[model samples]
Target chain A: MAVEITVKGEVMTALLSGEIDHHSAAGMREKIDSAIDSNMPSLLVLDFGGVSFMDSSGIGLVMGRYRTLQKLGANLHITGASPQIEKVMKLAGMNRLATIN
Target chain B: MKIVNKFNMSLYARSANEGFARSCISAFASQLDPTLEELNDIKTAVSEAVTNCIVHAYKEKLGKIYITAEIIEGGILRIKIRDTGCGIENIELALTPLYTTVGGERAGLGFAVMQSFMDSIKVSSKVGKGTTVTMKKKISPRITVNG
Candidate 1:
């Protein structure tokens, strides 16, 4: 998977692409978490426009990040999730915790 | 149990191999001409089963994971994932949603996801021996046949 981060004012958007499974979750988490810790952006956007496939592991990734951002008093926004990916997130009850766009 | 088709293979229990295992199963299942949703469900179930072997069973140690898929009568796909590694001591606890031994490292939803996606699941294991997860899904035929 490829992850790209861009900062705009107080927002940091993480553009993630490719399949997300257990193999990539931990590494992806570290990369995204470190960026959030250092930048402390007010809003963190997880853009899934490029993501092609994602399994339940993706839910854990989103949940872990939500906690990290919450600790830093930052909000999480999920955007561009394909319909299939959106259903997985919703089934995992992620919509209750983060803003899905 | 009459099977029309079957495939089985074993691969190393490496994190990198999880995707490979799942895609392989998905492609093989495509022979049944399952709907896209059914294909996704099968892929997700395979992912969870193989991931369990890599993460909990072997804990990064080199091990072998076996996968067997069968196309039973009526387009029922049955997949069995086996691993010869450390087995779960408490099967009940492990299947509980939100219960994880690795703390925050995992979401503890692997079994839940498998159970959700597959029509039936049977798990057998012995401490220090290994664990075997068998999941079955009924593939809804997308094309109807008229005689």
Candidate 2:
């Protein structure tokens, strides 16, 4: 998996691609958390448009980031999830933790 | 049910193998002519099961993960993932949604995801022996018009 981060004003967007599993998620989490720590943007957006596959590891990634951003007074926004990924996130109650689109 | 086709493989319990396992199972299941959604569901379920073996089963040590995929009668795909590592002490608690023994980035939703995607799932374990997760999903046969 790969993560590309961009910052615009107070918004930071992370564009993730490739299959996300336990192996790949560790790298993604470290990169995103480092960005969040340094930038501390008011909003963090996770773009899943390029992600072809994801399991519950994706949910843990989002939940962890949400918790980190929440402590920093930032909000998390998830977008571009496909139908299948969206279903997994919703089933895990991710909608209540972040803004999913 | 009669078995149409089947394959078995054994791999080391490592995180990197998670993707490899998913790809292998999905490729094997392709003979069923499952839809993209069905294929994705199978891949996701397989990932969760393998992840559990890697993350929880062999947490402190490395072991072997055995997998068997069989296409049975009626367009059903059955997958069994077995680990000879540390087995779960309580199967019921482990299957509960969001209940995880490990802390940090684990959401503990593996079993939940497996149950949601697969038509049926059976998990059996002995604390010292090992754990086995057998999941099955039925792929509806598609109709085609031949000219």
Candidate 3:
């Protein structure tokens, strides 16, 4: 899996690609967290357009990021998630934690 | 249900193998000509089962994870994932949604996801012996239009 970070104004977007499982989630979390720590953006956007597959690990990844951003008093937005990915997120009650589109 | 085709594979219980297990099952289930959603549901269920083996069963140690996939009668697919590692002490508590023993790192949704995606799931484990997760899903038959 790969995570690409792009910043615009107060928004930091992390574009994620490839299959996300337990092994890959750690790296993605690290990259996103480091960016959040360094830039401290007012909003963090996770782009899942390129992600082909995901499981509950994807839910954990999003939950962890939400917690991290919450501590920093930043907002979180998830975009480009396919219907399948969105279903898993919704099953985990992720919609209550962040804005999903 | 009668089995049409089946395959067995064994791999080390590593997080990286989660994808491998999913691919193997997906390829095997493809013979059923499942819809995209059906195929994805099977793959997702397989991923969750394998992840449980790697995370909860084996923990920090490496162990073998055995997977079996069978295409049954009437376009039904059955997958069994077995791990000979530390088994669950309480299956009831483990199956609860959003319950994880590993603290904040894991979402504890593995079994929940499997149960949701598969038509039915059966889990049996012995504290020291190991754990096995068997899941089944029926792929609806698609009607093709003749040209």
**Listed models, DockQ each:** 0.67, 0.90, 0.85
Local distance difference test scores for all models = 0.89, 0.94, 0.91
Error of 3 at B124 (Å): 0.5
- Comparing 1 with 3 on TM-score, the higher-scoring candidate is 3
Clashing pairs in 2: none
Worst 10 residues of 3 chain A by lDDT: A63-72
Tens-place lDDT digits, model 2, residues B37-86? 99999999999999999889989899999999999999999999999988
The 10 consecutive residues of candidate 2 chain A with the worst lDDT sum are A64-73
List each model's interface RMSD.
1.3, 0.7, 0.8
For all candidates, the clash counts are 0, 0, 0
lDDT of 1 by residue, A1-101 (tens): 97889999899999999899998878778889888878889999999999978887899999988888888898999999987678678767889999898
lDDT of 3 by residue, A3-65 (tens): 999999999999999989887989999999899988899999999999999899999899888
Clash pairs (backbone) in predicted model 1: none
Tens-place lDDT per residue, model 3, B62-138, is 99999999989998898999999999999999999988999757999998999998999999999999999999998
Locate the minimum summed-lDDT window of 10 residues in model 3 chain B.
B98-107
Superposed by TM-score, candidate 3 places the C-alpha of residue A65 at a distance from the truth, in angstroms, of: 1.0
Of all native A–B interface contacts, model 1 reproduces a fraction of: 0.54
